[model samples]
Target: MEFSFSNSQKMIQKEVRRFAQEELAPQYSRWDREKQYPRELLRKMGSLGFIGTSVSQENGGLGESYITEGIICEEIARGDCSLPMATHVAGHLCAGLLEHGSQEVRDAFLAPLLAGEMIPAFCLTEPGSGTDAVAMQTSAEKKGAAYILNGEKSGITAIMDADVSLVFAKTDPAAGAKGVSCFVVPRNLPGVTMQGYEDLGCNAVVRGSLFLENVEIPASYLIGEEGTGFKMAMRGFDISRILLCLEAISPALVSLEETMAHVKKRVAFGRPLATFEGVSFPIVEHLSLLEAVRLLCYKALWLRDQGRSSSKEAGMVKWMAPRFATNAIRDCMLLHGHYGYTKEYPLEQRLRDVLAIEIADGTSQVSKLVVQREVMGREFLPYNYR
Candidate 1:
């Protein structure tokens, strides 16, 4: 199997890395401190065709491969973990919805989202529901040519600045997962309101609650066939989790590089800290894990590009990468001594950002269940036996 990136992919990596370093890295701290969304920078990225890497050219996107999308996410997170949220919203969430959405839905939303003129949010998790998405209380009642939606979606990322949202609500609650349907809801709709949260990290893309109080949207806003929202959302996560893994791990990789340089030059006692086994071994271990996880991420993406099922590999990395990266970043922070604990260094922030990934798309516990279900057959799932 080929292990290296193609020339074009390498170019994408170099360009994204340069852009992230020059544009995102400098302003990340300020944005995080102010809890601001970097809309203008995201527009810049869209202009450069970085925001919609997997979208087709006809849809105002770069039409690059999934591997290219992962590369962009990795480089963006390497510079500033919070910034890649824009890519996640634009590339994974919006693009995935557009793929399954009706022509009318795509016509109204896709272009502007690809252009970064509008930001999109995905609403699935609710106040009482997360891992068990089918338990959502949100309901969309059909009324002639429209649907009236009423419920609160909690812990929704990018909700604070989203111009539109892909919301899932139950149309037939008795049908369980099959009862759910997806809708493209505009932020300016009469009954739609939002409240931002004070999250621990990745503050640039604020998490928030979406309160849909009898929000009305035309029937044409529905995505795909009725009762397929759960499957569509899961498919979107299958694509997104891989990118999220990259987002979580890349920052730690950055921290490792920075720490490596510091330890090699900064002397402790009679020699540099790099000379010590305790200092050096952890770095080696983290580096190895990072490389392995990164490769798995690419493999999953490559499998997707080939139209193969990668849910198993995706689940593996989704659980492994974030947890490992969090530990790695924590290790790097401790190695930095007192400096790492302070806000002056990015290590502390990186740790916080990576920590969020552990719970973002899916928790490690849930991801392991997904991997188990895939490996050991669906009959072996806890819920199945229970």
Candidate 2:
């Protein structure tokens, strides 16, 4: 019913937009070119409490609503899309896991993570398994008061710089999905090793592989009970998928804005480029499409803020936002003519970064199946069985 942000939400939005544009936008491409992780800037964001919005105020977080979280994510992304990999959805997942962690775990890890003094990585996907997370080969064997973790987690964001990792491994392999347990494993453990990747976009994120060879940790490091990790991860995904969509939307909207300004001023054949229906209409269409999805993104966040299930809406926008945002950015690039293709402009990089959204969090195919299962009932799911 309410269509506008609250006074507090608006205040947060204004500040975030200013910080993002002033501090983040200038170096957006610099990090990409230098392949740097922007750790110092991340610390700055943390010092300003911009990194993780979900932590409780008592826990040194703002305890803001999911709607507020989306606002920050979208605005920060407007300035630089790649940084949210460390601050938004994935950051939330790390926070969510730590929220359920034991007090000692929270004291040692969560505090620094929220403060931006430390980087956190969520380890769920491995080189050999992702969608079928139950089939993961990572294992944690309990011995005495400790658990020895051994596995390789690939395609992880900020792995190279992460001070800690929420590692997923099967404590009881025979229990299938139920056997999986989450652990708060320090990335600097004796047995841990890492290698960075040469990714196509979001190069600043430094996505890489994590190899744990007999990594040992106290048994208290296990998050929740054994076999509950899968559900915890899935629950976090419901909101994270929505956040990822908003991240994609931010850059697309910014790209469109850049294109809009260029077309309005650039003249062709004695007429402004914006005067052409071909030029103006596509801009209008992209704006309209993105606005609709943007509203849906917030709606999903609102439902989450209400403590209601938003998986259906999350799945719907998860696929649509990235697919549409990428299209809009690509068109924006084309509309900019030769200038768009060059790295001098942000369009090409925006296009490349947005393209990664189509695959991150969840693939378009998997997202559709999530919606299918939700809307049509589990009985109709392709993998559903009585």
Candidate 3:
């Protein structure tokens, strides 16, 4: 696969790097410490078309490809994962809607999202449903021309700041996967409320619990045909897992580079620490693994651009990148010695940030199972009956 970036891609990367250094990197530590999402910074990102990288130009976006989007994500995330995550959430959801939602639904939400005027959250997980998403208890009933949504969605990334949510619930509770449906619910509707959640990292994301108590939305808000939401959600994940891999790539590169510089200058026992094979060999190993995952991620993105099936590639990278990246950060921290344990250095924060990738989209074990199913076929899959 050709990994070379075109002149345009290089310019895009440069623009993202400048933005990250000037706007995001400086205040990221502060935001994480204070557990605040910077509204001003988000607005600035919107003004630059960073918030809608993959959405159509007609929808007020730059209409970047998955490769360009990945590059943008990696650059922004190199400074900090939280800020890039916020932009990723908006762009991925808006772009998904453009592909899956009705024209009327797209018209109402996509433009504002691209303009950075609206924040969108994807609400699929519930208090009871974690990995077993089909077990979601959230229920929506058709009432005349409206669907009365009554249930709770938990672990939403940016529900507090979201003006709209792409929510999934059971339209026919007894129908199993066939019962699932997706909706675009407005935040201001009656009986809809967001309660904040506290987490270990990515605090800038504004996660919360969404309670829908007989909230009514028009049938027009349905993203696609009924009973198809689960498939659409997985499709969204297949596309997003590539970007998430890119996000993890940034911090991995940062940790590796930072450690490289530190070890070269950090003297111990009459020589520089970089002279030790223990420290240097692991760094080399991590660099090699990171480059492999980077190529895998971009290949998946390129395949998607070509309208090819990328489930195997996506699942492989989804598992590999975060696992390797987290390990790289941990090893880098050890190389940093006593200073690594403190918040004064970014290693601890980088570890916390990249570790989340394992749990997001699909966990490491879950992703492997997906790969197993794809290769071994359903007959050999462990969870095939479930």
Candidate 4:
């Protein structure tokens, strides 16, 4: 298998890295401290084709391949890990829907979102159902020429700031997953209310719950065919899961890089910390593990580019990347001694941010289950007996 990035891909990576470090990395802690999403900075990024990776060239996006998009995700994440949750993960989801949406939906919502003039929220997990998403109780009933959406959406990212949400609700409650349908619901619609959460990390996202009571949207707002929303969402996850893993992995690598620089200059017992195997071995091990996962993330993206199903690889990396990223970040902090624990250091914040990835997109357990179903066949699944 080919293991090298093309020259153009390499160029994109370098330029994105430069942009991320110079523009995003400097304010990584500032956003966390202020608990702001940096909307204006995101606008700057959006104009440069960073946030519109999923949008087609005809729609003013770069029209890049899935692998290239993954590269952008990893690079952006290296600077500000939390930002990708809004831009790459949810943003990608919204684009996927809009790309298949009616021209009216695309013209109204997709354009502004691609321009970063608006924030988009992906509403899937309800308070009652997360992993078993088909169990969601939210409903969107057809009435005349519109669908009236009603239900509570919990664990939404940037809910307070989002201009629109790609909401999934069951249109036919008896049909299980097939009952689910996706819609673009504007946040300002009547009967829509929101409550923000005091999350442990990624505060810039303003994570919250959205309550929709009789919220009405036009029939033209439906994303695709009435019942195929769940399949579209699941397909998007096949890549978002991997993109998110890369986002998680990038920060851990950044933390390790920072730790290495610190150890070389930090003298302990009258010698630089890097001089001792005790201080150096852990860094080496983390680098090794993270590098392995990073390569796998790219491989998953490559498979998608080749029009193959990468569910197994996406699941494998989703569980491994965040777990290992958080582990590496935690160690990087410990290696820094008390300085890393202090607010002045980014490591404390990095740990909190990376920890959230273990749950986002899907939990680590769910990710492993995806891998198991793929590798061992669905008949062997634990849930299959039921």
Report how far off residue 378 is in candidate 3 (Å). Answer: 2.2
Which stretches of candidate 1 lie above 4 Å from their native place? none
- 148-232: candidate 1 lDDT, tens digit per residue: 9999999988899989989999999898989999999999999999999998998999989999998999988888888999888
lDDT of 3 by residue, 191-310 (tens): 999999777888878788999999999998987899988888888788788899889988889889999999999999999999999989999999999999899898888888788988
| Model 3: ten consecutive residues of lowest lDDT | 93-102
Error of 3 at 217 (Å): 1.0
TM-scores of all models? 0.98, 0.98, 0.96, 0.97
Where does the lowest 10-residue lDDT sum fall in candidate 4? 377-386
Better of 3 and 4 by TM-score: 4
**Alpha-carbon error at 30 in model 2, in Å?**
0.5
Give the clashing residue pairs of candidate 3, or none. Answer: none
Model 3 CA RMSD to the hidden true structure, in angstroms: 1.6
TM-score of 3: 0.96
Clashes of each: 0, 0, 0, 0
lDDT of 2 at 380: 81
- Compared with the true structure, the alpha-carbon lDDT of candidate 4 equals 0.90
